[model samples]
Target: MHTSTEFLLALWTLAVVEGLRVTEVVVPPFLVIGQRARLRCHFALEGEVLYSLKWWKDGSQFYQFIPRNDPKMVVFSVAGVTVNVENSNLHEVELVDVQTSSSGQYRCEVVAEAPTFNTHVLSANMTIIGKGRGALSTSAQFYLLETVNFGTQHHPYRAPWHALP
Candidate 1:
C-alpha cells in the first residue's frame, strides 16, 4: 500500500513539472490575415513585480509600448502591418493588417528592477495562413487616383473657356 502511494505522488510531481515550463509563453495559435490579433505574455511570481516589460523580434533590441512620444518606439504604420500594446496583469500586443511577414517567432522580455535580477525573456511562435478564395480585397484608392483622374476641364466647378489660350 505504501509503494502504491509513493507511485501516485511521483506521478503528480511529474505532471506538475510538465505543466510549469518556464520557457516560452502561450498565445493564441491562429489569426486571420489582414486583420487584428492580440499576443499575450504572462509571468508568475510570488511578490511584487516591478520591472520594465519589453518585446522584440528575432535578435533585435527591446521594444517599448507606452509613452507614444518615445522616438525609440516609433508609431510605425507600414503598408501591411501595425503594432500597439497594453500593459496589465498580462501584456497585450495587437498586430494589425497582418501579412506573410507577421508569421514568425516573437519574444517577450521582462526586466525586474526591484529584484535586481537579470533580464528574462519568453518566446512564442505563430504561423499566419493566407486568405484563400479571394478572401482579401485591395484598397479602392488605387483605382480612384491613377486610373480615374478627371482634369479641370471636365470638372463641374471649372468653366471650360477659363483655361483656353
Candidate 2:
C-alpha cells in the first residue's frame, strides 16, 4: 500500500528523528598502577546545565555525581567494579587512579533540568594492564656501593640467609 515517494519520505523522517547522535568518550588504552586516567565526555549539544551524571554497567548503577546532593566527590565500588565522579569541567566527568576493576563499558547519563533536552548516554571503554607484582628484593651489591668507607670495603658482607655457603 506504499509508493516509491512514500518510501523516500519515510527514510528521511527516520534519519531526522534519530539524528541527534550521542557523544564519544576517549580514554587511555593503558594506565599504570597508582596513576590517574580521565575519560572525557563531549556532546553535540552545549551549554547544558548537567544537573546529574551517573555511570552504569550491565544494567547496574555504579557511581553518581550530583552537585546539589554531594558535598565532595565520591568513588564507590561494588560487585568487583568501581566508579569515580569528577565534575571539574563544564559538562564532563573525570575518573582517576585507573585499576583493573575499572575495565568495562561505562555508560554516562547526563541530565539537564531546563529546556527538557533528550537524555544523553555516552559510553567509555576502559582497560587496565600491568599490575599485581611483588616488590623487588634488595641486592647486596647495591648496598656495597653506598658503604665504601665501611671496613676497607674490600669484600662485601653478605647476609647469611642469602649466602650460598
Candidate 3:
C-alpha cells in the first residue's frame, strides 16, 4: 500500500517538471517569396531562467537564440536560411527575403535553466505563394508591354495569351 502511494507521488512529480507554459504561437499561412515574414512564440516560465530558444523547420534546426549562454553566442542560423534576429525581442523573430523553400512547418522549442530543466515546444505551418509555378502552364497569362513609337497602336491592357505546350 505504501509502495503504491510512493509510485503515484513520483508520477505526479514528473508531470509537473515541465514548468514552461506556451501562451501563443503566431505564423502566417501565405507569404510572398520576396516579402519578409514574422514568427512569434509567446511563453511564460515558472520561476526559471531561460536557457535557450530554438526554431526548427520541417524537423530540422534552422535558427536558435540563446539568452543565458556565457560569452553570449551570436545568432545561430542555418546555411541558406536568412533569419533576421536583430529585431527579435526575446520571443519573436523575423525572416527576410522569404523564398519558396521557406514553406514548411516551423517549431519553437524553449528550454528552462536547471533544477526543473523543463522544455516546451510549439509548431505552426507556413506556405510561400509565388507569382508562378515551377513550370509555366499552357494557360498562363503573358503581358505585352506598350510599343514605343510603333506604327501601330497598342492596347492599354494586356490580353490573355496562352502558349503552346
Candidate 4:
C-alpha cells in the first residue's frame, strides 16, 4: 500500500545516511623486539556519529573506545599484546616493548551510532623480529641519514666531516 513517491523518498534517505567507513589502518609491518609500536586507525563518519572503536589482535579484542561510556576507554589483557593506555585513543594504540609473540593480524573496527549503526573493519599484519634481524633497509638507512638532526640550530653537527678535523 505504498506510493511510488514514498518508496523513492525512503531510498533517498538510505542513500544519504552517511554511513561509517575506515579510512586507513596503519600497522607497522616490522618491529624489532623490545621496541614500541604505534598502530593507527583512521576513520571517516561522514554525517554519522561514532558509536565505538575497537582494536583486535588475532581475533582477540584488546582495546575499545565508547563515546557514551563514563570511562570512554577500556583495555583488555591479551598475551603478547601490551596496551599503553596513556598514549592510546580512538585513532591510535601504542604497544610498549613488543615481543616476537606480538606478531599477528591487527584489526580496527568502527561502528556508527543511531539508526544507521553501520560498521567497518580493516586489518593489517605485523611482525616482530629479533634485534639482530631488524637491520634497516638501504632506503630506510638513507632516509634516516637525510632526516636526522644531529644537533640544535646553535650547534650544527655534520657527520664524518665534523669529526675529521
Best by lDDT: 4
RMSD of 3: 13.9
Candidate 4 RMSD to the real structure: 11.8
Could you tell me every candidate's TM-score relative to the true structure? Answer: 0.51, 0.51, 0.66, 0.70
Cα RMSDs, all models: 17.2, 15.6, 13.9, 11.8
Looking at model 2, the pairs that clash are none
Compare the candidates by TM-score and give the number of the best one.
4
Candidate 4 global CA lDDT score: 0.83
- Angstrom error of the Cα, residue 98, model 1: value is 0.7
lDDT of 1 at 36: 73
Q: Write the per-residue lDDT of candidate 1 for residues 9-117, one digit (tens) a residue.
A: 9999875443212345665555556767676767544343434556565555335543323442433333333575442223566776777676666677765445444
lDDT per residue (tens digit) for residues 108-141 in model 2: 6666656564477867565555432343544211
What C-alpha lDDT values do all the predictions have?
Answer: 0.52, 0.54, 0.72, 0.83
Q: Count clashing residue pairs in model 1.
A: 0
For model 1, the superposed segments whose C-alpha errors exceed 4 Å read: 1-24, 65-81, 85-90, 133-165
* Backbone clash total, candidate 3: 0
Q: Tell me model 3's lDDT, rounded to 2 decimals.
A: 0.72
Better of 1 and 4 by TM-score: 4
Output the better candidate (2/4) by TM-score.
Answer: 4
